[model samples]
Target chain A: MDYCRSGFKPKRSLEIILFTSEEPTRFGISCLGSRLLAGSEALAEALKATVDGQNISFLEAARSAGYARDEDDLSRVFLKNDSYSAFVELHIEQAPILEEEGISIGVVTNIAAPASIKVDFEGNGGHAGGVLMPDRNDAGLAAAELMLAIEKHATESGSLDTVGTVGILELYPGAINSIPSKAHLEIDVRDIEESFRNAVINKIHKAAKSIAKKRKVTLSEFKIINQDPPAHSNGSVIKAVVDASDELNLTYKYMISRAYHDSLFMARIAPMGMIFIPCYKGYSHKPEEYASPQDLENGVKVLALTLAKLSLR
Target chain B: MDYCRSGFKPKRSLEIILFTSEEPTRFGISCLGSRLLAGSEALAEALKATVDGQNISFLEAARSAGYARDEDDLSRVFLKNDSYSAFVELHIEQAPILEEEGISIGVVTNIAAPASIKVDFEGNGGHAGGVLMPDRNDAGLAAAELMLAIEKHATESGSLDTVGTVGILELYPGAINSIPSKAHLEIDVRDIEESFRNAVINKIHKAAKSIAKKRKVTLSEFKIINQDPPAHSNGSVIKAVVDASDELNLTYKYMISRAYHDSLFMARIAPMGMIFIPCYKGYSHKPEEYASPQDLENGVKVLALTLAKLSLR
Candidate 1:
């Protein structure tokens, strides 16, 4: 109660704004909320009593008295107090787990970090007609041979459980008759296990080295980029979620996040867990992307009930 | 005098037109006599007399005649006579043989036939996230595996000399994230030997079938296009060329044609051989592509002497 009237109490409201850019004007709204709604009255009384003890007779528990509105801006307002804050985020699972099982809420354990790499191979360029087989350095051919090598290595290295994928391969100077002097390719590697991850990288490097030697082409490898390993939800939070789900007679299964979320940041500061409702067809970041209203309501209900228990504690 | 005035009187100069497209125009002219010019008088006289002949006039003797003008076209007109006619054809050589050797003329034994094949690989395209191993028939993956199979079959069919090349590979609805539903590729195979050629085709078919079965993808293979076997030069004409070279005491080498030429038609009518003058840097069919005057004279000298000996007989 005291925390609600404190300055630290989060004020939750929907804010709408319009942003103009070269592409188009976008209308967006941010819905914010405070967790101290129940404690506001108690916090106000405590402040009133403190003013009286200081011998200020004119002090009264006036709700408007505590509210300070900015004289210059109508949108700005403030309350003087202090309180702690917490946040929760909700999203849909990318994989086909909740929908396939007809489950309402999915408890997520961890999110995998996708590692993307861009490898640019540079070689000497000469006339295709003038260069001989024994003396030529053909980067496009090298890139092609490397692509096949990666495929071959991926196939031979392990079972289907851990597969290496070349999701994108774009070649520059891509003319039919021109031998590419420099071939740039972006290779993405993803694996849940560290060994397999290293294996993919090592095998690619091996193939590149051997091919460079065979083709007489010089190659420089650059890592270009990487995202850190994302953390998993706390075991206690996961258990609490499971318990809450059981009490509500809602069935849930633990799953990997398989995507990024704002809650991913929250997991670093405090115990964190995620609830996923099914996304229809798992289409996301597209116009066709949609989630069922019933599913969203079910997920919200799960979140509300879970938070209710956590709040009492 | 009788031969020059009646049956084979020297005719007016003629020009040949090659093309009327946006491409560069090719022109040709045959001089009946030389006035300290680049052409031979004997060769020119022979051409004019036959063109003016009543029975063997240019129009009557033409394999196919268009409008005649006093303009030169490299694509059509060459020195013509009742006994023999020269054809000047301007074309591009797709191969790099002459360029590799720093030679001008390409004496081709045969021209490779272009073949088109329909390779239909039917596989299931589903949510890449939903489908697990043993349930997916990825046509693009199968095609990629089969590509290596093709390279392997061509390499191991006991002849490293055979050249099988892939021209186009297209995946239906190409998407990086989707499992390919179908993959179609067009491959071109070339070889000097017919046996090796047949072996390559047979092995590719075998590899495709085996890979499809192994990968659980259904592949339907059909030869949509095939050309007739490449024809070789006449043995007698080749021998005469060798004899002529020996008589000239010129430094020369007997080389097979690495490209198709217009003389392919002439081989049907009479024993035909080609004397190649070295093209400077083996350039052709472009304004920048050039052949030295010395090389042109060498070829013309060989042709003139050969014709002189044949005309006497």
Candidate 2:
């Protein structure tokens, strides 16, 4: 509000669109922003993908979208075409890079995408007391090995940009007195570099196969839930932001974003870039999330200058 | 039914009670038969005890038990108790003991109870992408280690009589893209000797404590979900079964019953004994579950003699 109040305006006419939406997709879910402006092509692509083991269908979205069949409400919801010439997003770094390096601004190189992976481990379930150690094929044990294997493989894989997470582990017939027959694990792997992500994924698959064979359990292939390729920043926007930061004499770094943003979708239609200011200890989506006032002001000034230069284009 | 068709009734007119009920309590709720037979005193004790984390109140039981109440026509249910002088149950040996040893009959010594243990692991949840491998207190990873540790501890433990199973493993905020904030594990530890079960439990607790400390995650002590102490077969009943096995010249072993039976509760009412026959590959509760006719016949004959002797007493 203060920045808007200041009598600072870009060279060309500026339109500041304020949006009131729900929380960020906490990793691609039933969200608001992305789905609204992503356009039909992207929506169709997303609809073709699978989420939480369910196929996302255009018909389903169409059904839900038309939930308010009353004329007045449905008219309000419409998809508009590619409007903006160029887009720039200013956000908190959501990581320690800028603060750790004491940089006032971060010129985002690329935004990484999460690769959802599910590994199904199947073994024979039996009475805990009846199934002896030597004879039993415990699926839970196999799953445990897979979790550790993910940590090992992800860490050892070529790129530090790669990250693997085994978040949801569910045991079928999950009883206190029965040996786990089926273990279902949901893993999320991510990397800005597609090849690096693929490499980490390959290692994970190999480990799962080896562990399952060794433990006498069946391992399912990596089920890709939802995966989008990394979105690279526009060169023009990047150059403008760099020049702006230099003019203001504020330290800036080119950093790849481990997190996703709305600009990823916008990048399809128009050139998109993101300017990031530091947050306290990289704490984001937390109560203690903070950014130094001076650093934020410095980032704002850089962003203003970048907008001024981009408007001229 | 065939065993009853033999028309070899005990001298004191025998009233065989045939019962049909729902499957075993997967997590200790919505089951019948045993609790009804157990007198008010025993039922009171059971109600006070927590089974699979549900409070055993009469109100809750009545509500679930009356699921069939809305039916237009249904058979009325009744609970009759303390009705017999002696109760003897004949079952397949779910364990490999009799089949491995080639014993015709098993003179049951005692039925071991499952020590239902639940380990609650609380760790700080964060975005899997944002949290680094080193900074993360990943509960899922810790749980994986615990699962393997259980397998190691149980297998390496002294007696084969002791069995540990981590059946149900649940990860909190179980999204593919979120770091597991908490992991709740249901552990079932069974042993014929009370001391051995306690020892194994102690070892498990110690291991959890150690793991939690190393991983920087918080570990809570084992919360006993439900525990039914080892039920020793009646001394006179054991002697009678032993004598019956001897008279038939069938090799028998005094075996501990790892599986539960109605007689586990019947022991509180009368002199209770169990006869175990060998099943193929020690498979029970499975479609392939099969007991040899010869072994079952041998077991039936022993059971008949034991009943005859007890009836005479």
Candidate 3:
């Protein structure tokens, strides 16, 4: 719609694509649409995924949504190697860096990748009062110790880019008077440098083992969900964005995107770049997440100019 | 049935009473029957209590169970001051102390009281990858810190009788890639001494405040569900239990009952005593929890002798 409103005719054909499941909200796999187009091996794993409480497989849901063509021949969804000249995405900067710096435009140089893991601890559950302190093997405390350790390792990784979160925690037979016999946690760690992120993850694993041993609990499971390498922006696409921002006289800064986007997978098939606009307090994935009209307009203008330059090239 | 089979009869009249809601499995109130009989002020609160998911009031359930005669005149259910001569309960030892020591009988001298509290933490939620380590105000981590602190304070309270457990933990918007915006925890602290248990609770409150302030999260709520004082066994009843065990030549030890029972509430209205036989591995409130037939028989014999003596007195 913005391109149509601009009324700028391009010499080369341009395509706009909106990807789905980039947030991993539905099937627990982000970049579902783009990953499939890029021919990710995760498709097999995702096909077996089931919706919680609904008892429906991802394959069934996809078929119901009219996505799957041939159940056995999924290659039909993959894009050809030479399908596009360049790919660029305009999105809200999901961090406070751009907004705090008063930058109108953010030229993303790198897209940080994430590594997620689910850890489950098993301990003896007894009456909370009946079990003496020395006799207790508390799974909840073990998970708590590991959670603090994850934060410590990420913060002490000697890089500000490193971040970790323990977002999901569950205890079995959750009652006020019963000791927890099982604790499960889902952890997310990210960095632009894969090595650094993995290093932090290694520390987490070691801490989990040590905590379990010390607490006399069992680290029953430590499963890694995904670990993808960071994607670097193409020089040509970066130059086009820089040139567009310079021509428009908009204040812009080169930044790394900590939030994942479809462009991360798109980089596998084509040269990919991203443009970011400042949102309110840099809040994303929340009800209060918002971007000003002026910021959106500036982003659209820069994106339009960059697309035109890429087409001419 | 055991007494009838033994062909043993008591010269004084005897009554067998079974209490309901001793586990707090319903309506979050333990010893509901005994508490009501002992004329606890908690009856007012219990009357307003509602079941989870079903949305039925405790009063309604009691009426449906044919227990409540008049909703407004609940005092009719209360036992008179001089209702019974003595109260004695026989149960499985919910801890490993007796089983580990190979003791056949446990003469409970005191029933440890529990103090339960529910805490809720509020923090900023965002994309796990987008939120930097330094910028995060994670409610889950805050709760974790407080949980560990509670354990530390209770363990260091200079009393082996002190114990604490964080049984229920819940995070809002619990997703693999989303930072937890809110965390709710239910903590149970117990001790044979009321002063010591209350001390640990006070330390927990202080630690909770400090953790919330340090993490820049809000300690939205700290609600105490119950705080009951420890109940001591009457000297006359304790002597009766000891004399009975001695007459049977059974190996016995005087111990504190860390788990609450109807005997605790009964102590408020009548002289009360409890006898415990070992359960497998001290496992209570679990499917694997078990007591041998021999242990059950021994417990019954001791209880029978103790009741016979109390009746004669």
Candidate 4:
């Protein structure tokens, strides 16, 4: 709106869309809006998705929020192949690489794909003192072993892009004096290369099985939540961004986004790219996350120039 | 009541007292009834103890439960030094020892004392996918390392009686895709030998510090909840139990009670001993926990005989 008010006009038509439910906070699915627009299978999931601890589905919530579209008219949300020349997203780097190198703009070539697994372990719990160490099958210990194994497998994967985290851990009948009878964990693994990410996941599964058997704990459940393929930026979009950065005399670096964005699913219907501005210390999804005003201005200038060049072409 | 109806009578006056809250389910303090009866410092703690998620203190709950006594009259609950000739408790062995050995009776020589500690770790949390492995200061990983360290220290403590358990684990902002920023754990360590138990606790504290420093996570809290000394059974009471078992031609073995009992605190005021009968598979504190009908009868016979003998003396 600021650029348009300044009398800057493009020959090609343009539409500014603000995607919704990109964080998965409501329906446990990221990029809901873009995925639906790109006619992806997530629409089916969204229709059936229910909010945690609630009786309402995502579609019902949308309806309550004034989205008055029937299932038959859902295609209206889909984008045609010729809907736009290209799609681009501007976001914080969510990592420290750009800031540490003193770069003003980042041209993302790839968005890392993510896979999540939920693991549950069951063991015979008893009095903490009564159950001798040799006779005990502690589920908490098994979960701990698996957490470390995940770190080891991802770190030794021989790829800097591969990473894993045990984000949630739970123990049943949690008491200071009673042994843990059950343990549950949620693990996240990601990499730019799907193969590398899958390899790490495989190792984690094997490790979970081996640890359960060795510790005499039961591997009750090992469910995969999602395994998405990495999305690559279109060549033309990349070239336009690089050319625009060079023309604007702004420092820029080509990087892979370890975090996925709306552009990931948007790439399915149209060419897509992403522009990243440096966030303080690369922190994201936290209260202290920050991006300097100067960096944001630089990112906006490059994005504006890139859009103008693409519109002219 | 069943034993009294069996045509058996003791020469001395007998009072059958039932203790309460030995499991620490309500006030987070085990042997609440006996701990107060024996005049331990726990009475003071109990006055300040509040039920989890409730506003009522233990004393208030006691009053609600029809316990008519003010703080000034609290001594009415305490037992005098010469309250009785002896004290004895009969319980099912909460371990597989007696059942596996096919023994009906287990004469307890000691009760393993318990010490509980609460630990909290803090780290820099970010997006699970965005945070690089080298850059992650994950509190969950630090807690995992510490859990394994605790098991290692207790197992290697060179005492069969030494045991430790991490029964409670909690992660802050627990989510499947977020790096854990904080972790909290409650640890239980126990042994018949206080020194051995304390040694393991010391090693755990050291390991926690080292792991925190190595992982760049902060050890925000290391609190000791309780560190009570192990209680030894009385010689005369043990002799009476042993003699009763021998005269009844019952199979018996002298063993230590890994599970603490009300008798642990009762020993402070009077000579104390415990008689254990075999339970099927030694399962306790669960729905599957059981003791055979014949085993219960045998335990009752021994108790009756032991009581008669002690009263006569």
lDDT of 4 by residue, A236-307 (tens): 999999998999898899999988889888888888889999999887777889998998888888888888
What is the iRMSD of the candidate numbered 1?
A: 5.9
Model 1: lDDT equals 0.50
Best by lDDT: 3
TM-score (0 to 1) of chain B for each candidate: 0.57, 0.77, 0.95, 0.94
- In candidate 2 the C-alpha lDDT for residue B273 amounts to 92
TM-score of chain B of 2: 0.77
Q: Interface RMSD of the predictions, in order shown?
A: 5.9, 2.2, 1.0, 1.1
> Model 3 over residues B1-313: C-alpha lDDT tens digits?
6666888778778889988879877677778889888987667555664564578777778778786647655667788778988999999999998899999999999999878999999988888888799999999999999999999999999899999999999998898777888999999999999999999999999999999999999999999888988899999999999999999999999999998889988999998999999999999888989999999989999998999999888
Arranged by TM-score with the best first, the candidates are 3, 4, 2, 1
Give the CA lDDT, 0 to 100, for residue A126 in model 2: 75
| Candidate 2, residue B96: how far the Cα is off, in Å | 5.3
DockQ, computed on Cα atoms, for candidate 1: 0.06
**How well does candidate 3 score on lDDT at residue A139?**
93
Indicate the residue-level lDDT of A134 in model 1: 39
**For all the candidates, what are their Cα RMSDs to the real structure?**
17.0, 6.6, 2.0, 2.8
lDDT (Cα, tens digit) per residue for candidate 2, span B119-234: 88877766667666666788888888988888888777787877888888888778665678789888888778777777878888889989999989999656875566778888
Positional deviation of residue B289's Cα in model 4 after best superposition, in angstroms: 2.0
lDDT of 4 at B259: 82
Strongest candidate by TM-score: 3
Docking class of 4: medium
How well does candidate 3 reproduce the true complex, by DockQ?
0.79
lDDT (Cα, tens digit) per residue for candidate 1, span B41-64: 433344343443245554343434
Alpha-carbon error at B77 in model 4, in Å?
4.1
Q: Which stretches of candidate 3 lie over 4 Å from their true place?
A: A1-7, A45-52, B5-7, B49-51
